[model samples]
Target: MLNRSGNTKYQIKDAQQVYRQLSVSYEKIDSTSKKLVAFADKCPNIDENDISSKARYATLCRNIRMYAVQVLQNFSLSTRRVPTEDEIKQARDAKQRSDNELMEKVILSIPGINGKTLELSEELKPFIQQYYQVLQYMQQAKLAGRDDEVKLLESNLEELAQAMRVAHQN
Candidate 1:
């Protein structure tokens, strides 16, 4: 019987309350996990009657599961998408690796095309221009139903790969 806007507002209020409760629960879980691990570490795992009770066995299982999580990944308690510092570093590292690969390609392509290998390298655009142009033309040739041209370009690319290999060795 409520209006659409009123229902939406009520749902939003309910969601907010649920989120608050989840936040509080996460804090408790985080604290309990730490304390439980400490307590488990103190308990004798090998003794005959050390972890005899069901509750102690349950604690051991929880401790092992948490240990696995800690070892396997950067664990987070937040339900939302929160970027941790490690995640940011990983993203930056991946981008740097990609850039390094592209630069290596440009360097190899230049030597293959008989371009100058100068001490001070030029910009990425000029270095990769000819390589991209040839690649683009080859793709267009294939799409235009030019099988002969495609075959020719494929062989040319193979030759280029060999040349790049030679250049890489040097």
Candidate 2:
């Protein structure tokens, strides 16, 4: 948890851990729901249709509340100081590597849909241009310390590529 109030700052690892916890909770909810449905079906006197939707809703609500509580507890434990300048530098490098991997997959794979040839023609040039725009926005985000904005721009760019492919095909 990165707190705007007080002096708390979260490292990237902390954010990743929170996200992982959320993922695990979602999986747990899915498994529990499946089990409940199976159990309801096994009851001889009860039709699946006779099973109360309210029970399902209540269980989902309880699971969500538990997830929220866990997240809050994690945040309460996340009162560490801001990362040192060196740690920040390392984080930036790691982020750059991750971005490079994603860009290679998402941007470079967009046609004139070549995976790695990197040749540009009239058709492919527009894709490259859009990618450059995304890169520029990402650079600005880095300077402004707005990494999430950069990721949003990347997602938008990826969507634009998909739209372009559809338009070109049509």
Candidate 3:
């Protein structure tokens, strides 16, 4: 029984060694990607088979590098640290500025607001006020454990802006 167990342990180690040998290294992948990109750039036209193959190889190399970086990042996630004072301050300042700009844009779109000529309906005033309130809440929420929520809000704001653009165009 002991002999079988010892053999099993050796087999596991050997498998790991083989796996590491086959896996791509970050530097090797980056070098290969650069070479492929150079080749692609030198090609006369993008429709050529050689250029296509080189582009595919370059994309593969980039994926390999990205996988390696993600693995490293996952390893670091286990020992993640809180942001330093400077980082926190910088993030806060950026959030404040972004929120200020967003507020200006939204208000300026309304008639009779921010020197804009479009008159807003009475029904829209409450919604606009609520929007500013939500923005204020998010600005203050940045200091709390709400970074992820703030990011969601920012994404939604982007979608809202796109919708507004479409509405205005129509």
Clashing pairs counted in every model: 0, 0, 1
lDDT of 1 by residue, 1-170 (tens): 36866663344446567677866766666676766666665555556565566457667858766875564334344355445567768999999788667655655555344434523244434435445566778989988999999888777666665545454445
lDDT of each: 0.60, 0.65, 0.57
Task: State the TM-score for model 2.
Answer: 0.29
Top-scoring candidate (lDDT): 2
Candidate 1 lDDT (Cα, 0 to 1): 0.60
Question: What is the per-residue lDDT of model 3 for residues 5-95, given as tens digits with 9 covering 90 to 100?
Answer: 5653334345555545544353465566566556544555445667667677567656666675676556556633445567768998999
**Deviation (Å) of 8 in candidate 1:** 26
lDDT of 1 at 67: 72
Q: TM-score per candidate, in order? A: 0.31, 0.29, 0.28
lDDT of 3: 0.57
lDDT of 2 at 104: 58
Candidates sorted by TM-score, descending order? 1, 2, 3
The TM-score leader among the candidates is 1
Q: After superposition, how far is residue 118 of candidate 3 from its true place, in Å?
A: 2.6
